[model samples]
Target: MEFGFARHMFVGALMCGAAAPALAQEANASGAATAASRADGGGIPDIVVTAQRRSQSLLSVPLAISALSDETLATKGISNSAALATAVPNLQVSSPYGSTQPNFSLRGISVANEFNANQASPVGVYIDDVYIAARTSHGMGLFDLDRVEVLRGPQGTLFGRNTTGGAINFITKGPKLKGTEGYLEAGYGNFDTFKVQGAVETTMVEDELGIRIAGNYEKGDGQFRNVAPGGRDPGGVDTWQGRASLRIRPGNGPLDIKIRAYAGQNRGTEAGIHGLEPFRTGLGFFEVNESRVGENQTDAWGVAANISLELSDAVTLTSITSYDGGKQNLQQSSDGAPIDVLNINWRSTFRQFSEEARLNYESDKLKLVGGVFYGWDRIVTDNSFYIGSVLAPGVDGGFFQHYRQTRRSYAAFLQGDYNLTDKLILTLGARYTADRGRYDDGYAYLFARSVTDPQTPIATTVPCAGAPGSCAYDPAAIFNLKGRNNALTGRVALSYTFDNGLLAYASYNRGYRSGAFNGGSYTSSSGINYVDPERVNAYELGLKGRALNNRMTFSAAGFYYDYTNQQVQDLRAGPVNILVNAPKAEVYGGEVEASLRIISALTLNASAGYLHARYKELALQGVNLAGNDLPFAPHWTAQAGIDWKIIDAGSDTVTFSPTINYFSRQYFSPFNSENAPGTGQINSELQQAGYAKVNASLIWVHDNLQLRGWINNAFNRKVYAYGLDLRGAGFPYNFLVPSTPRTYGVTARVSF
Candidate 1:
């Protein structure tokens, strides 16, 4: 797939110059207005968002964004972060681990294969305006959310560093100074799955103080059937989370404060791997033969405070402070075979603290926002790999790696919007960021053991002094590494609003991501190399408006990216994965989203995306990767859905929703190797073919009580969430992580 610059420019020009008048004319038509009013009573409802650091209508925002409210989330079955891709155009989420540690890709920009605990993702994740430094913690606080906003393209101006792909903001519901309210929900599903969730809110003082508490718990029997003797299933779910929030108005003054605390834990098995080679056990699909069952044990907690003080009618000051920490003890069988080929054990702890302060000024013709931010994070990992057992019987060979990494970031940003005329607006913004990263206490060791007695090591080699054979030591690797980066990023945009309420915008933005040391080094000291930071220059044209007198809402955008020094994880270079930077690349994409209320009781929504991402210059291990497609970037993606209110009574209503999502064929590696480089045979496992999934739900509501029956992946499609090529490591098999199978459940809820 290829998209040229000439076509992009031509389309942009058309959107900017010709489309406005046509849209305005259509909106002014009397028949359209009458039809819209008769279709949905008042047309589509407006959603207020904070994409620009201020409250505004979603259609009024000049950027490409997709927002999902709490009601939408529940009806769509977006219970976790990975499911978000189904609703948003040009967005993809993947992880080596299932349902957790999600790595987001926006507009074909992403961290392709890096899974080290110390490395941060290029796609920034935020909770109530606080950045989450740890990737493993991104899955938390997904429950009881007010809305989730996905900002596409470069968010450098306001979001600051490490947001080259984009950003996801999860805003939770806060306590309201009103009457007492609460809700309780419970569900049961296949595989013996059980779930319970609830929330309670109360006003401690009339219009002065309010508090809210929420919790969720879920457990289930695993989906993957372990066929090996005495082997347990590995895809089960056992997790629980709790949160408490307090809001203060302080005598109904201008000072507003919100304090929130949350905690969660996951005690379940890891995702089962599926091998693609013939040498492994001949098991059926969704069946794994493994000697050791992996475990997924994690604990996370955080606290945050947001304070806002109104200085006057046109000026306000806001401060946000947060601290978060988590720990994980994970074990996985990498080869997916009954034989002990490769097993990994990881023990890690992470913590982060952040503070941000901003001031906003709004007037008739001008608006300004400025902020200063500081963040610090640290991660300590003790990881071990058990290898060489499959090739050589009666001998167990393994290696241990220990490292501690700390990072500090400081940034200052300012943005201003001025109305050039009654219908024209111009926006300018910039941010200066400085980052420091230190990798210390890094060392590794080699050990050998007899298979008969795996508990004791027969031979051990330690590389650092004071480090015993049992692998306990500090910063004595061969060298300690420190990286520093300073960058200036910004955005400029021009927008026009037509008389018929149509918005057209064009923008240019620059985005930057910090550099860091390779945390995946385990074989030798030379493997711990530093990768340079990446930068992107993006240009975009977009249009957002409501048509048919508000019964139809639509948004369209086209974007092009000039990317340099793109960071990637190269697994074919050696036995261990290495971080490297691709010198140059180009990406272009376009997306369209629309929703139409066909009638008062029926609505239709659909979205489609097209992407062209390719490397312009890259050569690794004598293989030229130029003109190859980037990993995890599909050329085409689309989704369609319908919401129909089939029945309505005096106080009772029933609705049915059905959706389908489609994805084109996509490569998992940059090589895109069809014949395994010089072998004329077919390597069909390198890519996933085009696929589609179907989901449906039926909901009934009666006053304060509700019931829902839902089914996901109704056809039980065979799909892989992640894949890795082990051929470079002298293995004939490739590792593939399969997605969840068909699931059906029924839920009931009561609200007071």
Candidate 2:
């Protein structure tokens, strides 16, 4: 995989906003709407958004954003950012480490691989003004959410740092305006998964103030096995979470405040897979009744504060401060089994503190926003291991390594919109950030094999140490790694418009993700410092408009991303894996969307995107691989949906919606396109060929009551979703992650 990373270069200048409202439509996974309309008003309802440090209509800002209505979230079964892919168009979701984390990409870009607080997500995620520093945190279930806005492209202006591919804002609902209300949801699905959720809101001080609390409990039998000769029930973990908030209006003053706190816990078995050969893999892949390895357990907690105040006649100031914490301890497993007994136990923890302040100034012809942000974080990880296969010693998984890191970051930005004419608008934005990072990593390894089966010996032709064929295994030895890194980065943009609904935009966005010591540092042989940051310069253009009596909406855009000092993972013979700054790359693509109200109660929406995604260049340590299609990146994707309101049952309304999506086959590994077994050859993923899936939902909304349910993967089509290479033999050793199966659930909410 090529890591398209860029180092740091700071640049900045204020471009005041004195223009008209921006032109863009926000779509959540479920419903669709361009303008907010109210029966009470002649046209659209005033959508008050804090996206620019001020509550404004969606169109007033020059940005590409998608919003998921509170009702839509309930229909799609999306509790956090992980479910965002179902409706947001160009978003892709995956969990590489396990179900415990959410790894995402907006337009084929993502964060560098690392499990620590020092590294920020490529696409930043924020909830109620407080930022979620790690991707894992994004997996937490959301409750009492009012709306979710997905901002596309660069949003460095007036936002906390780290958004290279845009940002996602999770806005929760405020105190009930008419009084007390709440909801509850419960369901059972495949994998013996059981889930329960509930939320309670109360008007503690009548019309003066209120409080809300929500929580979730989920458990299930995992899908992997632990193979140890006469094995036991390997690893499978279940988790739970809770959240609370307090909203205050304080005697009609110009200031209002909201405070929230949360906590979570998980306990289960650690079950990861490993390829034994070609046919099947995992704990039971070898047809074993059981395996010797054991599982791990985990738990964690945190808090946040958000405040809004009107300082004077035209200037409004807002402040947000938060602290997040997490911890996990597990007895893990690794890829490839040299066998003799190897046991790894790891404990990881994170602490992050951040503060942001912003002010918005509004006027008749121009509007502007500016903000300052500072963040401090630290992470500590401890690893313990015991191996008896190589048999050089018997500490039985003794203290193997201890890792610690500290990171501090700060940023300042401003944006302004100018209405040059009655119809023309201009927008400008800029941001500057400074970063400092440091870490300490210590690791070592001992020899030990899985006592029972003891790793099988390797059989291969030896070219005789000095010959050219291959090196044969002599006396087995343990492997280990120890490494470290640090860095910084910054961005700017400008856009213009005209009267005929045509718009043009240009932006310069810089992104960075710090390097880290791959666990490889545990081995005794090689000494590799760390992997460097992947950076990108993005340039783009597009158009947005309404047509046919405001019944149809359309938009089209193109973009080019230039990458520098990319990171590439290298897998040599044996179990030696390392990361290095390889050759550079360039990506080109365009996206288009169209929606029409076919009839009064029916509507049609569709989107298409093409990415001429190529490496442009892929040189390793100096070897040029100029024209390779970037690994795992698909060239094209398209989605379409239809929603119909069948009945407006007087006091209730019922709507049924169906959606279908398609993604061309993507490569599983860079070297394997022909689907070769041992030689790692697979021209392209055939089993995962471009396929389509259908999903539908039934919703019933009535006075004081809302009932919703959905059915997914309706056809039960089996598809190869994701896999990894364990050794040189292409199909010899690998692991597969399956897509979730069908599920159906009902949620009920009442407001009085």
RMSD (Å) of each candidate, 1 decimal: 4.2, 8.5
lDDT of 2 by residue, 481-522 (tens): 333333233334455544434345555555655454444333
Q: For candidate 1, lDDT tens digit of each residue in 1-752?
A: 22342234334433433453465457654323433343346578877899999999888899999999988888887887889988887788777778767778888888865677787788889989888888888866367899999999978888735578899999988898887998999999998999999999999897889999999999998888888888879788899999999999999899999999999988878887876354345676778887677888888899999999999999999999999999888888877877777788888999999999999999999999999999999999888778756425676777777788999999999999999998899999999999999988777776675322353433232333322343443334345789899989999999998776778999999999899788887755556777888899999998887766567777888899999888877654335556889999999988877777878789988777888999999875457889988878888777778989999887899999999887777777777764445323233576777788898999999999999999999999998887776666556577788888989999999999
Q: Which stretches of candidate 1 lie over 4 Å from their true place?
A: 1-24, 28-40, 276-282, 390-393, 450-478, 571-576, 674-684
The alpha-carbon lDDT assigned to residue 246 of candidate 1 equals 96
Scored by CA lDDT, what does every candidate get? 0.81, 0.56
TM-score of decoy 1: 0.93
lDDT value, candidate 2, whole model: 0.56
Candidate no. 2 TM-score: 0.79
**TM-score of each candidate?**
0.93, 0.79
Residue 56 accuracy (lDDT) in model 1: 94
